[model samples]
Target: MSHVRVAIPKKGFERFEKYNPENLKSFEQLIEEQNGDTYCLKLNMHLLRMYNAYPQLVNLKITRLILLKALSKLPYQHFNFARKYLIWSQLIDDGIRVIIDMADLLENEDYEEFWMHYKQKATILPILDGFDEAIRKYICFKVGSTRTTVPCMEFKMKLAVDKEVLMKYITQLGWMINGNEVKVFPLMLNDSNDRDVIRGIICSDIR
Candidate 1:
């Protein structure tokens, strides 16, 4: 795996692989990966609260593993180049495809497989784009029609929660553009790694 060259911060991954998940620092890095800039997408804190509140979704760590994927369509406007962990989906399926896929991946605490899947820089964007479309379609047909005040009303109702409490948190992180204009276009390539922010300080001797 060392020679495989994962896109993650090498030193931080070393700690993650070595230290206990219960160890505060290792746990913090995991938390960072969930909500931090390592990946362009982030978890919806509100959806996470919902997942936590439901016993069926409890104890699976599904919130941590799947919530970010649920919100993968969001944009990340940072400039770090070494690690292009942009998670976008282009697929057109409803939600079933991704939900089943995510469930299979997390079924047995398959962290290594998940890590390997995410370390790729090439496919994250397309996968996210696909997942985004899937979510919209699934929420519409299987859950509710887009004509409703809330598109995914049926899906939310399945959770047995009030629409008010199921407050959404996705639009907060999307691209912002007024009049579809751009004021600046900075052009420069950076070879530096975003590992420090993502995985914390890197150690010269990770061994």
Candidate 2:
């Protein structure tokens, strides 16, 4: 598989080395600006090094920051981002391994296994706000885009949420619930001409 190589900024690391309680807020802002880039991965590694140097600096906030940065890479790097951090296991904990496994499951669309791991190990670090909601959005997008209709029970299982919550999500997407199934509309097309042509082809194929 091909991968994009992102150049890490040396100046960023130089500035990161000066991070302390006094400047942590600013440091966080700098890193957040670099989110979704490979530079964030390097920053996370630097954070692990700092934690190793001063174990007292390790806290829920720090761990959550690292985990969030790792998660931000999921769309581009998938589990590879998690795996890159495994070399520091002696300094950290098994949380990296758990994240790697969970990421792999999610990438493979194995929502059941992902939830099992999430529920089992979520307490290892700080609670990731909106984690479930983000995963649910991905599930809805993936299943809804492909399937015109899905069994309500199956959709609930895929989202790993209760019926009430599922209803809210589907309703927000403008889907209709009929007995045991939920209807999913195709994605909207912005261009009316293209939309008409696509609809005609679909109708002809169905007929």
The candidate scoring highest on lDDT is 2
lDDT of 2 at 99: 63
Report the number of clashing residue pairs per model: 9, 0
Model 1 alpha-carbon miss at residue 38, Å: 4.4
Q: Which residue pairs clash within candidate 2?
A: none
**Candidate 2 lDDT trough over 10 residues, lowest sum:** 78-87
User: Candidate 1: where is the Cα deviation over 4 Å?
Assistant: 1-10, 15-21, 24-58, 62-67, 70-98, 101-207
In model 1, the number of clashes is 9
Worst 10 residues of 1 by lDDT: 74-83
lDDT for each residue of candidate 2 in 144-170, tens digit (9 for 90 to 100): 668999999988998888988988998
Question: Each prediction's Cα RMSD?
Answer: 16.8, 13.4
**Which digits, one per residue and each the tens of the lDDT, describe model 1 over residues 43-74?**
12222323333423332333323434533322
